[model samples]
Target: MEIDRLTVRFGELTAVHDLTLNSDCGEVLALLGPNGAGKTTTVETLEGFLSPTSGTVRVAGHDPVADHDLVMARLGVMLQSCRLYSAITPLEALRLFASYYRRALDPAPLLERVGLTHRRAIAWRKLSGGEQQRLALALALVGRPDVVILDEPTSGLDVEGRLLVRRIVAELRQSGTCVLLTSHELSEVEKMADRVAIIDGGRLRAVGTPAELAAADRRPEIRFSAPAHLDRAALASHLDATVTQPEPGRFILALEPTPAAIAELTVWLAERNIALSDLSTGVASLEDVFLRLTGEHQPEAKGPGQTP
Candidate 1:
């Protein structure tokens, strides 16, 4: 999929401005942003739901709008607000959509993969929100599409449900399927995404691997504990870095983790006759980059490997 110099305008407000992005087969390209960041608009344009105000958007080398039928056949979209028959059972719904395609996966295996085998006969209205989301995922894959667009697939899911989706994403990547994932889960994006794109206020902010984006505007962080509280004003005069104290005797310094920098810090601390402990140095994380670029506070991760 390719979006070259694309822009979307709603009257006088520009929802997207000169945005260009792409996703290669066998790769997961994660689109991340704060609210009202034009992520949905960009995805909808590629899905052929809305026409672009300017520039080009294509899927599988075909114009999404001009060749809607061809693109529709190759793409599977799992939208957040996907409408379904509340009275239909999971098994019945999967089979129903399978019949619409020339080739489709068997409904039985899909039900098992999504962990909905026990609820196969339960009506949509009887299932919980997470269960409904899983059914929607199965419906999207029933057609065996080449490109899958998932918007907040893990939203409202329990621990087991979230793991199931992560496994499915890895499986899709191994099968050489292009997956466009959009979610607020930065930690999950860190683990699964091959490339990350961050946008804010309808403009592209940064794009790269998680590590690359983290290093874009960051310094290595040096965190240490001291025997006593260091004077913040005097420390500023001795170090060429930004310092923060979250605790009485703990200090975090933002600077390059080079040999010279470490030597300077050690020498300075020794001259002051202060004992340092728990010293560590590392670069920023994807969440750190997200916070810096989008100017938003980082929320706590849902769990160790689960993301929402």
Candidate 2:
């Protein structure tokens, strides 16, 4: 899938601003941003749910808007809100949806893969939130689509539900399905995404692998046991490090890039004969990078049909 200069506008507001991105076959591209960042608009435009005000969206070499039917045949979508008849059983729903496609996977095994086989005979509305989400995912995959667009597939899910979705995405990748997913859960993206795009205010801020983003924002931190009344200012002045208090009796020192921060920290502590405990070092995470790039505030979560 390729989106070049895609733009979507609603009256005076532009939801997506000249966004360009691509997803390779069998790759998972994560759209990371807070609510109202145009991630949903971008995905919806690519899936043919909405036409772009300007620019082009191509899925599987076909334009989504111009070739709606042809593109729909090759694509599957799992949006945040999906409704199923309350009276229909899980198997029944899958079979009904499967009938619309030229080719589809068997409903029984597909239900099993999504961990809904036990509930295959149960009513759709009787399933839990997580179960309903899983059924929606199964419906999306039943057609064996070449491209899958998942929007908040794990929203409101428990830990187990999140794990199930992650496993299903991995299986989809193994089967050579290109996936474009939007998610607020950093850990989920970190685990499953091949590349991540940070979108804010309807614009792309950064695009790279998880490791690359982390490395780019790398900062070393030091932890040690100190007196409860230890003068943070004095310690910082002495070592020339920025100090942060994460908790009572716990301090983190951010060091400069001259040398290994840990090495310098160790020497500074040794010179003062200060005993350190639970000392560790590591790189920044996607969440850190996101916060640094988008600022600490989270955008308001908008409901469907609301203009971004």
Candidate 3:
């Protein structure tokens, strides 16, 4: 799958801007961004639901819009909204979708793989949100697609549901299917994705593997929870580096968290009689990289109802 210099516009609003990305078979490339970041628009173009205003998007070496039927045959999509009929049961829904593909997996084994065997007989409207999500995944896999797009696969899922999805993703990777995943679950993305593309304001910001992105910002730092409204300037002066409170009572010191730096921080807190809690040292996290890249105060992962 490839998107080369892709741009999509909705009249006065530009939803995507010269975005270029590609995914090879047997890779999970995650598209990470807050709401309104053009993730849905990009995916829609790839699915042939929307045409690019300029540039190109291709799935299986065919232009999605011009060759919509051929692209749909090889591409499986699970959008944020469930696409199954309300009255349809999981088993029935999978069978119906499977019939569309010339080569398809059996509904029974697909149901079991997604841990929906117990709920296979339940009506789509009667199944829990997590159950419905798993069923959607099963439908996507029924076609044995060359590329699959999963939006918020783990949203509202329980621990067992999450584990089931993770296992299935692993199996898909082993089977050499290209997977494109979008989610707000940063920790999960860090675990499942081979590469992550962070975008904001309808433009690409950064793209790399979890470790590469984290290591991109080489500065190590200490994070601790303390009373809110502390004097940041004084702390910065003492540490001789930048000090930031990403959230109230949560502080980050942009200095190497070496033994000496840690000791100095402790002594400073001791002298000021400030209580400290939850102190730890680490390099940048995927979450930290996302926040820095997007500059969003609070990144909310929701369906792009407000997005153009």
Models sorted by TM-score, best on top: 3, 2, 1
User: Where does candidate 1 have its weakest 10-residue lDDT segment?
Assistant: 298-307
Q: Residue 18 error for model 1, in Å? A: 0.5
The C-alpha stretches of model 2 lying farther than 4 A from their native spots are 219-253, 257-282, 297-308
Q: Give the per-residue lDDT digits (tens) of candidate 2, residues 97-145.
A: 8998999999999999888899999998899888899999999999999
Positional deviation of 78 in candidate 1, in angstroms?
1.1
The residue-by-residue lDDT of candidate 1 on 139-236, one tens digit each, is 88998989999988888889898888899999999999999999988788888899999999888999998888877756676767886457654664
Colliding pairs, model 2: none
Best by lDDT: 3
Q: Using Cα atoms with residue i matched to residue i, what is each candidate's TM-score against the true structure?
A: 0.81, 0.81, 0.89
lDDT (CA) per prediction: 0.84, 0.83, 0.87
Error of 3 at 272 (Å): 6.5
Task: Evaluate model 3: give its lDDT.
Answer: 0.87
Model 3 clashes, total count: 0
Q: How do the residues 1-308 of candidate 3 rate in per-residue lDDT, one tens digit apiece?
A: 99999999999999999999999999999999989999999998999999999999989899999999998899888888776798999999999999999999999988988888888889899999888888888888899899999989999899998888888888888999999999999999998999999989889999999999988965677878888866767777777766777667877777788899999988989999999987977767898789889886432212222231
Q: Which residues of candidate 3, in runs, are more than 4 Å off?
A: 225-241, 247-249, 270-282, 297-308
Which residue pairs collide, candidate 3? none
In terms of TM-score, the best-performing candidate is 3
